[model samples]
Target: MPVDSLPNSILAHMLAINNVPPPPLRSLPRLRLSKTINYGQLNALCHIRGLKSDQHSSLRLEAHDAFIKQYPQIYLHEKTVLPKVPHLADKRKSAVRLAEKKHQPAMPHNISAYLREARGGPSIDEEEITEEKFQEFLNILKKLPVYRTKHEHNMVWKILKNIPALTSQLSKEDLKILSKKVMSETWIKASTVTGDDGLYVLLTGQARRRIKVFRSLIEENDSIITSLYRDSFLFDAELKDSTVAQLYVPSKKLTVKKWGVFGSLKGGHEMNESDRSVVTDYDCEILKIPAKEYEKLELEKVKHENAKKLKLIRKCPFYETWPTLSIWELVSISKFKTFPPGHVLVESGTVISFVGYISSGYCNIYRNIVGLVDLPINKVKKMKKRVYMGKLKEKESFGEVSILLQAPFTCTIITGREVEMAVIEDKDIQGKCMNVI
Candidate 1:
């Protein structure tokens, strides 16, 4: 019988019954073995027949008594232990002692060995997990402390659980709903209220892909998530275009929270927070124009382009104090550019390298003000992009301030709608327009 197979109490009695060899002389408790038996002989006997110490004897009876008292309606089986301690040298005693302190008892140390003696050990079987049991396990995990917050670890698990490759048995609509839930509450930005433009653009793409892949994984769970998470996806997962990677199979599970880390490693493009400034609402001085005054400035600049013929610059309350230049002369003095709807024109902190003048088309200016605007003001207020005479706009210019002051671009400029504007370069404006300044 294996040493562990015998009950410790029964093994003790059996050892007493046999003329068993004693423990090693140096390590032995008070008793010494007769010279008739050597350490080798004692070891051989203990290998064939098991022995137990007082602590083990008491533990065995306690386990039995507790089992019997609780499970009177159920039958209890005989206990067994395997004698498989590997021999190690004494110099490792410190490490071995530490490990012994942390050791946990195993029920069947080896399933194969226990199966061979199934008629003897504890009554539990070597059970195979079923689909239902897997789901039950998942439910239990959902209730664990780890699942409460929207952490990357927890999000990954939620992704795996909610997706269909593992749960095709679930409904299509159910999977769609799960995908929706993932997006609505998953990874959120931890930085400024106005997102970094670079990060915002990248995240916009990521959010779209996460939603799509999450949908596809569930739709074709059997062939998709399994292949990707368990097989080939690792090689492709780090793409900044997460949507592309998500479309491909996972081969292995993704555990990282920050998607960019994976994207950079995979040779995907990275956008720095500096690049992401487009998302922020730039702080700009507002230039509100009366309808008639704005209309007159638009007519002269757009129609004649003759700075000398421009009456508005000479007559207007806003532009009168401003240094004067002729209409055609102003065109020569400034550079011109145009933007259509949805175009990002200027960014914050960028050198207000040049001042702009709106010749035509409506324009709007904005700054990031939290608890104020939900969407971009142009979108929410339905405002057209306009040139601010007092505030910065198409005909209105800014970079001159920096050139005059020799500072960086103080504010960002973005197009609210398509409009044509002139950029008055510092040299033309300072050398010529400032001839009047």
Candidate 2:
């Protein structure tokens, strides 16, 4: 009989009874579904590994076997291995729990805990600096040069507060910036603090100005003269027009004491490009401010000085009758001046050519008197003595009488402290105030 026409059961029985192979194995549609799945095969029984992560990976990631260890076999009946679907009532309970978590009352407790921890940490900047520490910092800054102003002092404190030495922290990068940009150092005893540029100051130990010897001189007791004609000659070519025309070289060692500023400072007008070496006598702590930094601070000081002058003008009773334009013009024309203590603003016999408004500190007004009259009885006459006439306090004016009469004043005006003044010289106020004059 034809195998095609025979029934599969009858044909399989005949072939088994005749010891013949059961009708030749035939390919049938959908027959392969009954076979056991090979490893790493995709089928309807398994989905794309049910996205194993919260962030769904792509097919490219799947090709790289990222989806390995997903199941015992590549293809599995997902209904048996996957989590069971929740009932309607259970889903409703889950939704209620999620809502409660979203609207929880303890949220503020978490926020407050975070803030407390942040506060408990070490301070990072000036705002976090304690009062005691800030005061100590101010004291330390007094070691700097005299150019330090109240505003600049606070700013410098704020700027340097980030240093690890001050903050009690460690940072290689911050230290590098500070030591490079803000200051330079010399570690050895014989080394020079400022061999190049910048203002030099000693923090610990002492140093001396190294002066070259010009000649050797003999005295009663063996002595070396470090300076000759110091007060006399106009020696310093660099200080040609300055009042400090003479050169000075100290005979004593360790003349520059601790915390003493020596280079490129405001008061050091004699500082030149010459190699003036300050040899350290012992282990020294040195600090330096670059010339550029000094220039920047000078600008800020000028701004503050101008504002202070404006304030002083408003306080002067003499300016109360002046018009607003005149006041502003005076403010613009006034020269802000600073004088050191014991400085003679106007000598006793010299002409007083400028009117001064003492903006800060006090001054002593003195009249030169004949100590003893030149008499025939005494062989030598006594020198003139200075008698204190009065005090010129802040907001007081000087040279007003001299300017009014266009004559010289007999009294001497000496600064009692470092004084700041708003000076209006005759040349500056020339023809603009003819009506007032």
Candidate 3:
């Protein structure tokens, strides 16, 4: 029988009977004999392996083509196996590992010990400072050529100016005396050292003058003088003119007596006619005024009187109780005026200066008393009489409550006698005092 006409069962029986093993299943090598053979065998293999026939056939064909292109020698061999490949080391990772291995050990925990080791020796001990040691140091400093020089004087003055406590303790009069002594000593020293008057003139005439003026302003007690000192740039402009000296001379000589608690108690005792001693009064010429400048002199006199009034006001009970009212700030905004006897200082329902202090006299306090009855239109209007409150004497203050409350005065204040008052304006109290407090 022809091979193409044989029944498949009979052929399989015949092959099994002859021990042919079903004509030896076609090998993978046979599949490459023709493209048609490869496709048919691959599809049959896929069916037997339980995979999609078309997909498996395409994948296998592509892998076979790649293998044949890369290795033409082994592409046709069915039993060939690929050789093992070795992994390459990364150059960057190897270099990092080598650097870590070559580095020095970790640094010592103690910083000073590490520094000593690095420096190759122990460090030397610094000199200890004590009071005695400091004194010796000061002595050494004094022996230096730069000591007491013009530069040193300037440095010392700058130091003193910066220290408020030290400057506050020194009065202007004290600074004047100190300036004279320093100038004389510096003049002598400069003359001896340089063997010429040039250094002496530079030291005493220029340097010492500057020191005196600076120290005087720094230690000044009067706000007006301080303001003038600032306005004149440490008296540089004003001191150049001789006439300006006359304007400030009265302020320097004027003194205001403060009534302290002890002084008041003593004054009360001495108020008795028997205990009071008769005193003689004398007029001394404090400043020489030319006839042409008589009006200018009167204006200066008024200014001096006002400065005295302010000085006394600073010692009043109100200022003592509230120390935040800076004397300089108060003097800048306050007014000093004298009121005649029976003149009203403050009236009820009126806004005026917030507070006033009796500098040299007394004032009486009165409050309006409201009546209950309604008056007829034709009836004569009875003047509302104000009830008498107490009296405010010298060194006492009034109107602080009205100033604090920002309201009009509730009572009337009248001068009981000729009264000298230091009035702190309502605007000033709100502007300056409230900010500080």
Candidate 4:
């Protein structure tokens, strides 16, 4: 029977009788034989096809002899068998093409457009940014301290130019807000300096309604001579010694209790008590108004209160040593609290958790005295002997040493009269006010 007409099982049995090799049996593309056929049956199929088997291996011997004759060195050193199938050269060519394609330089569309513009090619039109938006951007740039230098300003411009969204279709106010946000996120170290030019302009303006005069006592033989202007005042009538043509700057050590209407004429100089002037013989109430209050009045009437608070702060010995920024921070965190006469502000041996500044009225300090027997009938009877340490008047601060040292109060502070004090708690200082300066 023809092989095509026979069953696969019968075909396999017939091939086994011919001694064909199993490998050659599989190489027959047209034949579909049983997968379960034994190796002996596959070997028989090669014999039946007139292909070489183990029993007749003369074909392999002939190929080996031909290879030895063609390449003697390879045949002498290494025993090798020639492959039945040839390798496709086209596969190597395809692989080389694939590798070249992967390594080829290809620019993205956006980058190409940028390059084209740089080369002065037909430029792509960017989305139009409004003039208002640009102005707002400039304002933010002006506010930043780092942008004061030309190089930093250019760097900022370059960055903004690269960001298409920042330049395209954002509103003026929105752009300003977004730019500030981006600046804060990117340059965390950058700080903005608050402008006080408006405050200065308001103080120097020619509006009499804006200025207020205050009277202060200048004691006899006092070395300090306070004046609105070092050389000359705009309101000369306000000064007690108006005849003096050559006005002198207040001594750096002079402690100015009240600022003249024009403030200190000499800028950037601090006045203290140790600073003496040429004329201090007259004992009269000097007329003056705080410049800080005058400046604040231009912004808001409520801010005028900050001037009094600032004055009080300037008088305190502890606050005098602090920087201006630190003083501002302290003032912001402190709140005013009032106590009636005979009220004990802090008891001896209690935890010192806060500091207080005497804004108004007086307070007395009493130390705990030992060796004095006391009755426990009432709260006042427990302390039979109390030694008065000192008195704290307006503009004085107490409890700072205890609070700063993180210790208990060494003495009891009692209100001698109805007093108002600015209290700054330790929690508030550490939590919100610390490191601000």
Winning model by TM-score: 2
Candidate 4, residues 299-322, lDDT tens digits: the string is 453355566667778789767777
Best by lDDT: 2
The TM-scores of all predictions, comma-separated, are 0.23, 0.31, 0.29, 0.29
Assess each prediction's global lDDT (C-alpha) against the native.
0.39, 0.57, 0.46, 0.49
lDDT tens readout by residue for model 1, 1-437: 34444334334545563447543445433432222324453344443322333535765455445433432222233458889787576548978888987895666676744542342212222154345654453344334334544454343344334322223323443333332222211233321111211111121112112212422323454555564455322222334443434332221222111111111111123433222121111221111112233234447555665443254234433465655444446555555567796565555445554656665555445453334334755554334333332233433433546656657643445565677766676666667765444
Q: All predictions: root-mean-square deviation over Cα? A: 33.7, 30.3, 29.6, 25.7
For residues 1-437, what per-residue lDDT tens digits would candidate 2 score against the true structure?
23444335434543453456664557312222323434445332133443332334465346324323333354344445878777999989999999999988763445633542353321234456566665554444554435445664555545454533324321443323333335336456655454345555555577666554433232333233323343231122234343323233432543555435456534343553222446566777666656665555667767776788777876776876667766777777788789899998888766687889988999998999887656686666778889998999988777866776677778888999999889998776665654554
lDDT string, candidate 3, 291-362, tens digits: 223334446766886678667766886576545346656766777778899999889997666578778889
Angstrom error at residue 6, model 1:
99
Task: Write the number of the candidate with greater lDDT, choosing between 1 and 3.
Answer: 3
Off by over 4 Å in 4: 1-301, 372-384
lDDT of 3: 0.46
